[model samples]
Target: MERNAIILAAGKSDKFAPFTYEKPKGLFCVKGDVLIERQIEQLQEAGVMDIYVVVGYMKEKFFYLEQKYGVKLLVNNQFGKKGNLYSLYVARNYLKNTYICCADHYFPANPYLNDNPENLSYRACTYLSGKFREFAIDYSDAKVITGFNVGGRDGMAMVGHAYMNEGFSSVFRQFLENEINDFGVSDLFWEEFYAGHQRSLTFYMKEYQAGEIYEFENIDDLREFDSEFLMNVDSDIITNICNTLGCVPNDITDINAINAGLTNVSFSFQCGGEKYVYRHPGGTSGNLIDRTTELFAQEKAGKLGIDESVINMDLSGWKISHYIHNARNCNLEESDEQLETIMDYLHRIHSVDVASEKNVKVFDNVAEANKLMEMASMIKGNLKREFAVLIEKIDILYDAVRADAKRLGYGLVLCHNDVYEPNFIYDSEGKVYLVDWEYAGMNYAANDVGSIICRYDFADCQIERYFRAYIGHELTDDERRFYYAYIPISAYYFFCWGLYKGSIGENDGFFFLSSYRNMIRFIDVALESYGIVI
Candidate 1:
């Protein structure tokens, strides 16, 4: 059989942050040497030099290894969504007589040889005192692998390294190719597959002495093995995580990356036996959001008991908040009861007595978007003419709403300018709280109301329900006209905001068009029914 090796480096290593934020865990430098390079050098010393590395998280960074160390690179495009089982599946063809390796594993010396006593393949493990809840191995007296457990008292803990002969690889590959297509089991570890098929396979347990192998489950492990990473890991996220929770890096575990956030990069971790979220700003957030005002709004909301998930938020725009398990966003269009709950929170937010220079003037934003579109060189041709016409229509509606605000004594209150489904976190106990105060400022309370109406795409008939549910009573004709006019103006501002985001190279054309088309219909309604034309 031909000697070969497959190294799995495609995992994002959420626990390895904030180093993995810049590069994958395999690229981390330990003792002045790249982690993956050391593993490759050790494999070469064992005469298994034909190494194939499957990379996904930071695949480009591993490209230079092809020329430097004569290793072949295989790409796993689903690395972010899938686990190491998929990484190994990507290299399924090269499993014969192969030493399966992990990129983050640190071996003190070469563990392979050119010749062995027999053709038997093995699963390597290290004995532990039974404290950590890691995968444990169970074997018979002849050392044939029999079964596995999640945690065992003083038993061998399963390590990543393993070997497979021609026969072993042929049988395992058949199982892999069959089960991988099932999306339900796509996230399973390769050992899980082995656990399922242990009865049909023959394998031996190769136990290693203590201090011979290193998995570096956390930063403290890597720092202990190689003293370079000392008192602090070089990660601002970790620094902030430690500072906010008053705990060391090791105290933070179960770190899973929450990649679904719209304008932030976040990870959820458990510290001091409680789950919390750490959000680092992303996209155009640094330039678009005023962190100072956001800090103040959050503090104000905290005191008002509207939202208290905020643990700490720094000037650098990184934030830590307690995670609400099984929480869902507030979608009023779906549930009228949810609408009442969210509006109560909105009403409380609008009633706050605070002073801030931050102000939201919708027409002013439309004017600014006009300037940004021309400056980014995006305005051109028929699109420019259409935008000009839209602005003209918005001007009339803007004047109409301004007249209503002045004559009716409608004053500005603290408002959450950005109100969408995802911005509200509702827990299982029927408790809901608003999030993302970056856009909150002194604005008309209807600005918040219009946000709910505009985002949910409420129909003409449904406006009355939202209006009555918000004001807690049947509306007067003047109040009805005042609120109806602001919804289209809100839609126009959203359209302009989308245009501005697109000019900066965000994929927001759908947003711009949806709001623009919606605004055009409502703008005409306001002009005929609500506009004073003064």
Candidate 2:
């Protein structure tokens, strides 16, 4: 009876954040041995010598396993954007008589066995009372799994390791092949895929004693198990965070990656019983953000009661903000209920006195972008023609915008500067708060309007509607022209920003194309409005 194992080491879970940023959880050295390597040894001892390691999210680091353990590596390239079931889907052909295992789990003793090679089973452990968090299992009197739950207590909890006989794998392969193209199915894990169809299937629970199946759910668990956790001593992200917070690395716990912004990488962590988000500067971020100005603007927005509390921010673009829990970003669809509050916040934000901070407007951004365009070797090689045309019209576009902006009779003031959908958060109290002040500065309030419009690609009527709500007035010709002029300027600035970001390998795929196309479209419209050209 020949059997093989599929070790899922692909998707990177942020539950083990700073530790798993560069080194995947599979590679973590747990209790004097790497996690996945220990699993490999156990599987080999169980006579499952022929193994396939599904690798992604730093797959190159697993290349040594092929030489060291003689295991085949099946690479899942879309690992960052896809879920774990896709990993199994890639290894679907080899699921026969297979032990399906997760790479990050640990066991004090060998759990892999070939004695029950013909049985379809999932490993589980008892969680008695007091409300457990893992997937709880319900089984029939014959030891067959009948159902599973997410928030149940006093029952079997899934340990994420399973085995499938040839008959089960044969049918599962069909499910995998059929569901590969199914929408929303790729988001679930293989266990979840099975759980969805549990009524039609039978999986006997291989029950383990409580605490036998080990998973380090948090930093405290790892440190309690091993005081000399390398995440504290070796990780620079931890060192910088602790040094700034004036605490040791062990004080930080429950680290998770937040929604990664285009300008910054953020992660949520708990320290001193306070949860906060740490923003790490992303690629090309240093040149893009002036942190001094950002600090001033963010502090001002906070004072206005329209932003989260900032814990610490420095000149290097590293920042910590008080995390807003139970909140979601706006959809920015034309019909959203949150739009009125968001519009009110924008107007309130523009009233701040920013006389002390340096003003950064669309003109300044365009000048900075021109430098990025020339230095971008990729763009210089391919987009030279389009770049040349936009470069030639920069002066025309700026001059038109500047003249129209003068018609407003009020000078530039502070603004959120980048009023995209994700920058606005509606907390549980139904309060709309602005965030991500990296681009904030003393810019025309028109820039905010330009930002929301260009970022969301708003139509003419929707634009008119929001602008009407923003100003609370009828369409004044000068005000409309002023905003229309910013459309081209903002679009061009975004296009060049994309050029710079693209050169640094932060390729914003569709954003770059659409920004360039919109820049051309609005540039022509601005010129036509000025009655300068055809």
Best by TM-score: 2
What lDDT would candidate 2 get against the real structure? 0.75
User: What are the runs in model 1 whose C-alpha is more than 4 Å off?
Assistant: 113-119, 183-185, 220-262, 266-278, 282-415, 419-435, 438-445, 452-478, 484-534
Rate residue 383 of model 2 by lDDT: 58
- On a 0 to 1 TM-score scale, where does candidate 2 land against the true structure? 0.65
Clash total of candidate 1: 0
Scored by CA lDDT, what does every candidate get?
Answer: 0.77, 0.75
Model 1 has an lDDT value of 0.77
Residue ranges of candidate 2 with Cα displaced over 4 Å: 80-82, 113-133, 148-151, 195-202, 216-233, 253-259, 268-277, 282-484, 494-531
Residue-by-residue lDDT tens digits, candidate 2, 216-319: 77656776777767553466677767777888866777777876678777888889999888877774677778777777777777787778567777777777
* TM-score of candidate 1 versus the correct structure, residues matched by position: 0.62
lDDT for 357 (candidate 1):
43
